[model samples]
Target: METSGAPQTRGARLHHPELSTLVHTSRFHAGRQPGATAVICEDRRLTYADLHHRSNRFAHALTAAGLAEGDRVAYLGKESEHYYEALFACAKTGTVLVPVNWRLTAPEVAHILQDSGTRLLLLEDAFTPTVEGMATEPPETVVRLGSLATWSSRYDDTEPEFEATPDTPVAQLYTSGTTGLPKGVVLAHRTFFAIRDRMAAAGVDWIDWRAGDIALIGIPGFHVGGLWWATQNFNAGTTVVAMRAFAARQAVDLIRDLGITTACVVPAMLRMMLTEPGVGAEDFTTLRKIVYGGSPISEALLEESLTVVDCDFAQIYGLTETGNTAVCLPPAAHVPGSPLMQAAGRPYPGVRVKTIDARGRELPPGEVGEVCLHTPARMVEYWGLPDRTAETLVDGWIHTGDAGHLDEDGYLFLRDRIKDAILVAGENVYPAEIENTLESHPQVAEAVVVGAPDERWGEYVHAFVVPVSGPPPTARDLHAFLVPRLASFKLPARYELVDAVPRNPSGKILRRELRDRFWSGAARNVN
Candidate 1:
């Protein structure tokens, strides 16, 4: 990471020990660096003062609309200053902000809105039709992105009259569950700042944010990866350049034009940007470090990134439930032809990682089993799903549904997912969610979904279907049927007609049996 120059007087003290939550940071930064740019999205720019006052005004508007502490306020839109305004607004009022992926189908969007018990939805103008179609039961209040400024202009810009602590819930991000539905992962303010504090205490500089750093956030704010990265920059009082939606060409231009010093992106994004025309070392001169994760990086891609982008590359590994990243492979380990390239980085300070057997017994190093993480960054619980929360979080340790082992050096080597979830371009695609939708079709008697290796997307969804009787449904027919029911990424890229889905005596469908066919020669179970 690029080191900071002489620290600005009042701005340097914005990181006071008392500024533990968003409420504190927002207020502190506004007073310290009112004119400093906090966020940049296309034509919109929010200075530290603008972010604080606008969020405060919106917080009053939320209260005026009868949203009290702990109420859920949802945002269905792409990355923008508005999303962060709503995020900080929610934080100031003790309300939880739920950021929905804008790419999801109407039904998928409806599920998140209803499941979260959302009181108000702050929507983008583009999704008005999608929300209108959800006539079933939508949120009580809906505010369009276009009118947010005018609506909040009537309220006072002063800080809201509410108390917020480090443990207050701020964000409730939904992650696709293995049971065919998405569950809300409730995160406290501490979750956003825990790893930073840990790193400072441990004197670790693996992922440090410096002043004057222009950080590019290519990932949308909906995902934890995006949210965490953005907040980390915000907490450090750095300028954030957020993309409305990731396009390879735009990303390349943004880095060169905006002079982005650091970036956090998935490996797929980096790959796409490299393929853009005229992309060369000149496009990355200002970039000092690039942190990538969401899925494993291929050796070829890693080598190419090092040679072409020619920047320090750090790899992070974690789930949404872990508040983004618990493990980070620092820039020092990005050497080509090294075995460390295949390993997920070591856990952050104050984070504990171990492999556990099916019986919940911790295994020794080099033994692959279910990976578990105990970190202060872990989520509070799976919102409103006590039983599900119990199943995952045991004794403060999250039983990550991943199969991995730690080397003697403490680097994690992920073998496969213990849960049958597919990582397509960075979004989690659960097979059960697709299977449930597929089985709803008249021609599909039974359906199974599995992740197939893909060169660009890391993994693609593949479906094996058993017809009810007579002629089987063609792949084209199935694709059309699923277009409006599931997100585009969740749709199967390939389909096969099967006579029967293999099952155990207990009637459990053998997903592994079908999945193994496509992964026979792969070095790892996941792409």
Candidate 2:
């Protein structure tokens, strides 16, 4: 009911007033159209006013629980209005928000909570087993996030004073790396606002928010893509349908049933949707556009999706460090079976993209090098890792470990990853993370994980293991061991028993040497 506000003047306010932090975006929308439907999840539909009030109450709840300004709060659950409530509440109170991956194992979850020094954890009931089993120090304070209605009612709707300034860190996103444990990337609220202002200034109406737009969010909000995409629609005062978890059929049905104008997802998601039963061409009739990224969509899949889905598709190219997307392959560039489709597109306004060599000097177009960018939304620093932060963030530029080149037409084309990371359905699975799990097995002498070409999921995990003396463990044994420790996506699709793992003279595992043969025939190293 009254979801659209009588077509407000386009590009009303790029950033929230005064502080220019994400803290007040919901309040601004609440002031614009309090009655408009803001979020739809399961049996609940929250209006803009509801979102503002609820988030404000949640903020009060945080303070009442003894949370101080800049204190860390972690959310370990699925996508729900409560997550948004906590997210916005953090912005208002200057508390740090950490959306933990619910899919991670107990130890994985504990590591993030401990690393961030999270004072409190807001968890759902389903994940009780995961948290209850954590080996590390459990959070000092815990709140049942899903059952917050009764608790929040005790607090007033008075908005928490906006405390975080433009340069203050708002969110901490943990990202896995090839060399060590997951690193937390600290992002400032101004970064999000700056990125939005840049995108709005570009004048790409197809990608920009407008009246009557209904957004279906399929990605998990824990990831940068999901949070940024959802916030983009929320700021636009559009009706947002946030999926609890991604299911291809659910997405296809929602696109038709909810008359969703646009959806943001990755290539692997599209592949799954196309294969789902009853997912016909007519099911996508209501969709005006589909924004896809993370990893490149296969040419065959892209052609099939274009034929079946009667809507323009756009591609976003960026990373967790870059806030979200800094560049985009617009709908106009979505020609079926074209070379341009292979490129990652040009940089957005306020973002400068270039290729740089080992010397850190900019390379000319067409020269392959590390694909780096200077975005207004760059992460403040890697939490606690000054050396790593220095290595990645140099002179206001993000050194994306991706090796790629720019074409004559300024299109950014990805070639390979300079880091040993496997892209499993848009989620990064570091070899070290998996290898660490594997080496822990008493029977396993060593293990190596690499991305192998996969038709459906873009690239699936493939592990090569060297066993200790006796007959090696079967795939079943390995699967059983991994099922409880790692996420399903990170589990190897297939395993190979090897005599010895490839290693350099210094005893470091030579992963590229092992991957060279499998990827040599492919067009690019990355799937």
Candidate 3:
């Protein structure tokens, strides 16, 4: 498959089978590479043969325990090798796996479990306290994950027969709820495989993975970043080193001790790792590639990362609906002063990107507007939300609410999210552009721009900043730095210093929270 340039056809569909049945591919490779390590956890290492056989046992156990095909089973726990076993066990039995984020509060986790109508909840022992006292709709069974003794003794010897067809729903991922309550994004085997194939065809060399190559999966499996990468690694016959939870020191230690070559992380994780003491070029000697996404990274941090980490950096740009990455900035573009480093790079081989205005008219290059993406990897629909599905997926294009522009070279430059845009005196101001300018200041460590309610202008830009490792800059000093970098209308009217900004697990700023502070007493949520 070609990994560069445009796709040959407009309506090209993926050739991979249903995702629930996709486990068979890994199982087949498992027998051929029985001794090859498939997963390495804190204190456990499972070879390909072990993983395949154990997941088979898990499948039989689920069936014996009354889990039928298409039954929803939610896995609520932290990242571990057992998480993969639980995930594959669902696929092997044709059950839909719903991985609930452990970072969420018990109430939030309960809401997801309830919404999915899960028949079983598989949890880790470490998180038992969090779920034990929570009021939730009781599933048919509550099994503790990672119990080898129980799993080995429980199920029948007969091999269970199952196949995951393209139409079979493999997983239901809930939205990150950046704006409001989370909604389930239902994906099938076809969608998952399409994304993997699309990514491989877009310059990602998955086939180059050797049986001995160790891949680090630090991100939680609940997010697309963790789930998709793990699946891809498994398919490529590579071993995965699972981190139970993300810790800067742990990540560094894993790389050094486990000989981790490839890893996927968000910008926030990278920042945290860089802040750790004793972290330097020598720490990441075995590391080959670091794929980063979820939010825009500051240019300063991006540059510093290249100097600090001894590995190639690839930036990806996509949403959950678009199978995680529809655009990729390859390793070569990570060059500090390169123009491609500023843009999000061109669209993936199988994806088509366009800019459009409010009326849906296509905007010319260099025109800032909503980013519209067309790809085979686009999600089929939002589960139970037909109206929202229609509103978002139109004319074969997913209307990404993100506002950006494509340069003449087809490089994408994100301005701001449409919902985050501040309307002041009838002029549109993108907070990202202003925040990016502000973050470039020598005294600014981090900056979040939000729209504050104004009696006269309707809404004005409000800046919240975190100072660098020096004397804090006053509001006036920040304004002076931003004045020349941005337009007069875009300049923030109110400036406040914050120790830290509220960010989601994906590192996206919670603009709604910033807006909520100014409109606390008001009826409506937005300014």
Candidate 4:
């Protein structure tokens, strides 16, 4: 068996030419190293050969059911080997894979399916009722996760005849809708491999894959980070261990037992694993690197991680539109007490980043403005939304609604968010979504949502509500009302019943005024 390890030559392709697309990536590995481990999810272990054959069978099944190029297929379930098989099946058949977060409410799931024009839905058995309750227009075909193997078995394990281009849309990931409705972000096959190719050409090992290295997928497949990390490992012909869902104790056990070499996680996940009961340095002996992002790591937590983990720590910063990570704080700058610790590192090779003022003019270093990024890994567009796409992606640069300044040396320091999205344990929660739900309550006349700093979970949702003429509803009353409509992460941890919300002369609710109360003593408004 021949496995392509870490890239060794500068200005060379990361892998063979055949690995351009996800379908070709699977075929290349299966042909070169058939028996190599591809994915390990709980009790299930799938080899490269198995993955290739199973995905081929699923692809055949999809095509047999009339799904053709550019069709959308959604997967609503926990992370598992079947999910990867479905993903590769979509890649092979030239269909778009829409991964729905299982934690979402039924209405949320339905919105993604309807919004994406999903033709088929592959879901877990537990969510059967969830789909059945979608009285409105649902997916045309629904296949339970357990029956997929049996259903796909009727077809032969032959590769699909269709070939997807490098620019072909393969995945459509939904973002937490900043405007009360989530939008699907369409990503091409190139988004996964472009950064690796750039890194190989630049001879950089900031985030590298090596021979005999087993990687852990701490993030879920529903997020771009998890999918990108998994594909990066598969492209390198390395083994991957995926958890159905992230659990701190299971992560610690996997690191200790599976000889896991590298893992990608968020700061909150790292904190949980580090603080897991009976966890210590001895359990992380085989771990080599931890790539963390989604939220910045506090100095106290970073110091504790450095002392206990005894491994290299790297930070990644980007949005779903940037295909997970465009800026990486490499391990070389992980020195404790150094000023660089507070900065988000420079862009990867073949990537460009800059800050711009409200007038759309580029700003010089030391000037705070909206952060923008341009990379080969950028998403194609927000599905079915031309105006939204134009507003976000201007002149090939993604206008990340984040407020930050670039230092003289090019290290990016994040100050706050230009938009009103809350970061709850690395999950994006829009304020408008929560405010809309709160205002739906009969007793609530008006509502304002904001993000409040917290030691755990990074930030918690805080809501201010104005009641009707009669009696006002308590925080508990609103919490109970929202439980069925909103995801737990988006629910406000604290609520204040006010006679009137602070507003400007134009009747625009003053969110910053209410938000400033919680962040008065904090160094930066964003947690």
Assess the local accuracy of residue 116 in candidate 3 as a C-alpha lDDT between 0 and 100.
81
lDDT of 2 by residue, 347-452 (tens): 8877899999889889998887799989988899998899999999989889998878899888998765667777888976666557757766767766788888
Question: Candidate 4: which stretches are off by over 4 Å?
Answer: 1-18, 420-527
Clashes per candidate, residues 3 or more apart or on different chains? 0, 0, 3, 0
For candidate 3, write residues 1-527 as lDDT tens digits. 32222222322221222222456655665656678788888988998787777778888888877888878888877777777777778877888889888777767777788778889888887778768656875577888876644964577533468877766777888888887678777766665566566554554542234335688886778887788778777766677888988899999999998888888888878888988998888889988788888788888789988998877888888877876778878787778888777787677677899999999999999999999999776777777788999998998799999999998878898888898888899988998888878888889888999898888998899999999887999998998987887889999998999899997754567878878888888876444
The 10 consecutive residues of candidate 3 with the worst lDDT sum are 10-19
Which candidate do you rate higher for TM-score, 1 or 2? Answer: 1
The runs of at least 3 residues in candidate 2 whose Cα sits more than 4 Å from the true structure, single-residue gaps closed, are: 1-19, 420-527
TM-score of each: 0.80, 0.79, 0.91, 0.80
Greater TM-score among 2 and 3 belongs to: 3
Per-model C-alpha RMSD? 11.0, 10.9, 4.9, 11.1
- Cα deviation of 433 in candidate 1 (Å)? 25
Best by TM-score: 3
Show model 3 residue runs off by greater than 4 Å: 1-21, 146-152, 156-159, 199-211, 504-508, 520-527
Superposed on all Cα atoms, model 1 deviates from the true structure by an RMSD in Å of 11.0
| Winner on lDDT (2 vs 3) | 2
